[model samples]
Target: MTLLPDPIISTWLFSSVVFGPWSNHVTGWWEKKQTHSKLLYLFYEDMVEVNQITTSCAIKMLLELEYSIQVRGRVQFENMKKNSFVNYFTSLAMDFKISPFMRKGKVGDWKNHFTVAQSEQFDEDYKKKMKNITVQFHTVV
Candidate 1:
């Protein structure tokens, strides 16, 4: 499993790649879900549907700030989720570009870019790599 980033930044960073049959990195986290609720599980296609990356990042940033070690014991999750990011980035809006962060957050996106055999190869590898793990694989979309 990959090591999680600093908790402060982790809250603001949403993953755009977490799907079935080919996501050991993602599954590892699922196995430890209770340990890391700050990890926003997002697919590539979701980004395309939303069309806003900065807003997503800002929300994450705010979430992290409110849910870190200093506040988790005192704040209720419902209250934190209710806050919006509409005014969070006004001071730094032009400092960052959104295109690089926006991508085709879609499931099966590989189908359009990978050959049938290549896809099968990935599945084979996935099965082999996950042989000892007990988690069941399921398609999300």
Candidate 2:
């Protein structure tokens, strides 16, 4: 992974590619979720369509952000996708055309891109780094 200057999606998916280990970000919120009512800890795979709607509504309500029906329906997700401020795909740092920001967001999609060696390396690294992390995440749904 060090041979390449920029990490591919595989390494980024594993964690700590660009910034600090993603585990650090997640672990920071670990104990907070237990004490905080507003903290919505979630796994993408566990969120079905209904859960997604409820979660989105809960987030908006918690943040006290109001959105009109028409405004919400009009912009949709495309609004964020097009807005350079919110979309890193528009950034010059890395080319999104190569990996694409919104790839198929299905469970176990990592298997499609990762090889056996890469998977082994990631697993070993995960064990070492996540030794104290209490969050339980599964790669496949």
Question: Tens digits of per-residue lDDT for model 1 on 1-141?
Answer: 222234422232223332233355656776675477665554434433442563345356566644454443222224333334321334343332342222243455546654566556557766776776665554334
| Residue ranges of candidate 2 with Cα displaced over 4 Å | 1-16, 31-36, 49-91
Candidate 1: pairs in clash: 44-105, 44-106, 45-105, 45-106
Worst 10 residues of 2 by lDDT: 1-10
lDDT by residue for model 2 over 1-141, one digit each (tens)?
Answer: 123222563566465654446666767888788789778776656543344465566557554445434434433445545555554644466676675554455677777666667777678867887788778878765
Name the candidate that leads on lDDT.
Answer: 2
Instruction: Give one clash count per candidate, in the order shown.
Output: 4, 0
Residue 86 local lDDT, model 2:
50
Task: Quote the lDDT for 16 in model 1.
Answer: 33
Q: Which pairs of residues have clashing backbones in candidate 2?
A: none
